[model samples]
Target: MPRPRTVLLTGAAGGLGTLMRGLLPAYGYELRLLDVLPIPDEPAAITADLADKDALRAAVHGVDAVLHLAGISLEASFDKILRANIEGTYNLYEAARAEGVRRIVFASSNHAVGFTPRPMGTDPLIPVATPHRPDTFYGLSKAFGEDLAQFYWDKHGLETVSVRIGSCFAEPTSVRMLSVWMSPDDGARLFDAALTAERVGHTVVYGSSANTRLWWDLASARALGYEPRDDSEPYAEKLLAEQGELDPERPEHACLGGHFTTDPPIWPH
Candidate 1:
């Protein structure tokens, strides 16, 4: 089948979503924006909570594919995570299936495997087959999303690509981010690959630039035709000079998820 051209982009107002909004257009996609929060300068962007099933179905109608990015991004109380991340994702998948959307690109997080030990020295890169060891309610929700994607593909013929994204910022600010940072351009490239890849039943891939200090393997991502261009090494010197080298003794630096494992963030009520 030809690549899906009309896509429903959820979470249109968030940091990453906004970046995608600008870049995906360059790849010949007609994005239909949706989010609970209103997107500026977009009168057509749907502003509805994920809990609203009726609005979700309406938002997904006629879209060739869905890029599901709406959810509580940080560690939150279990209830919040359940509602926004867990149940909310379910609602979107249901809507997509009901609307006959061909595929979904799920924005999963590295925190889903937060407890996994980071590769040091010659240690092997973490594989996509790594078992889930979520360190927080937020991470748990992402893990749930991954499982849900698989279930949908198995039973409902809904294809999905669950991207375990690292820090996708314009620049690497901290030593930890240097290991996992995905540049804005590389992120766009990964998404484009995911959208166009063939025979993706329920693929799982790490999302990051070709960083020199990468902790996870990119083979799965590359299988989808993703070729990450940016590297965080240029910024490594400044970050290392300021923060010093990662000490294996430090709980935060010992894992791929960084401080998220050491101190899980709770959403402020």
Candidate 2:
């Protein structure tokens, strides 16, 4: 049997973080959870601000590898993204280097390329290797993470993989989701590929499902041995019936689900 690796997972209290926390144990990993809030059930969790160098160092100590999911998640002010996403990610990479951790799996998002046109509902899903066309501050923050991954892999000996997650949800909720939905089971597959793949240095891959209707080519993901079984296309008819059609010309509908292209932006007023 393979030895259990110590996996330090940040943001264990958040949605995706929580999902990964429960799943890591099943994958033969000794899990260490981290978040600003207290971990549920008081499992082995570190509560601290990721931007605090000393705190991050403490969290990284003795962990063989890291799954960095901690960061501001949505379209927020530049200040929030800078502190939580940018600085916090930097702190993790530095801490990982100091602790001699071997690898890191970063949680990037589809928003990183939100400016690119999402082909119409009739078109195939875009592939994982698309060029980044960020649409919001949050998207830019994820882009920074990708760049940081490259720098760390080049300067230090650390191996890094950036998973640009699409819409991760319990189920497809809207018309746009037909192209973006990523189920938890599929997410686990994506992360598993990142964790155990061979010779992946600072590579960026989309986190999506194996839907036949998906637009993106998953050849890069397949190279890492990721085999997603779920498909978002099944929910297409139902979601479209409920939400009605969005103007394909609208930025939100036209490109990358209008996440960055939406008018007025979905931010606090």
Candidate 3:
């Protein structure tokens, strides 16, 4: 299939969304921005919460595909996570179905399988088939989103690509990040590939750059035509010097989710 010309970018004012806003247009995508927060310079952006069905319907209307990046991006109370991420995502998909939108690029997360042990030494890279092992309420919400995407595809024929994103930042900031960080440029490339890939029926791919020290496999994403151009190896020297070697005994270092694995549960508070 040809690349979608008009794309609906939810959470358009968030961190990743902001980065994508400036970059996706360069790929020839006409973006219709939406967010609860006001977009700084984009006066035409639809400022509405994802829970608002009517607003969501309006946003989905006339768009060729949706980049579903909306939702709480970090660990939060279960109530908040339920409302913002879970219900919010369901609402978005329902709206898309109602509006007859066919394709979606879901912004899933590595946290969905955060409790899974990270590969050590020459151990094989973690594949996309890994089972769910959510480390936080935020992670659980993403897991639900992936299942929802699958359900939508199986039942309603909606095509989706659920990108289980690692740490996406301008630069790799820590030794641990060296294994997971995805450069902004590679992030755009991965998303573009997901948007343009033909006949994707609820595919899931880890969103990362071609880092030499990566802990996850990119074969699934590569199959979608993603060619990551950046690596975190160059930042290894500085980060390793600052943070030192990871202690295998540490619980945080034991899993793919990092600090999220040992962090206090957010919902009971």
Candidate 1's TM-score reads 0.98
Model 2, 259: alpha-carbon shift in Å?
3.4
Q: Candidate 2: where is the Cα deviation over 4 Å?
A: 1-4, 121-127, 263-269
For each candidate in the order shown, give its overall lDDT on alpha carbons. 0.93, 0.82, 0.93
TM-score of 3: 0.97
Predicted structure 1: lDDT: 0.93
Summarize candidate 2's per-residue lDDT along 120-222 as a digit string, tens digits: 6566667766777788888999989999999999999788889888877888787777776789888888888888888888888888898655656677788
Worst 10 contiguous positions by lDDT, candidate 2 = 260-269
Model 1 C-alpha lDDT per residue in residues 233-267, reported as the tens digit of each score: 99988999899999999999888778888786666
Ranking by TM-score: 1, 3, 2
Better of 1 and 2 by lDDT: 1
Better of 2 and 3 by TM-score: 3
lDDT of 1 at 56: 97
Write down the lDDT that model 3 would get.
0.93
Identify the superior model by lDDT, candidate 1 or candidate 3.
3
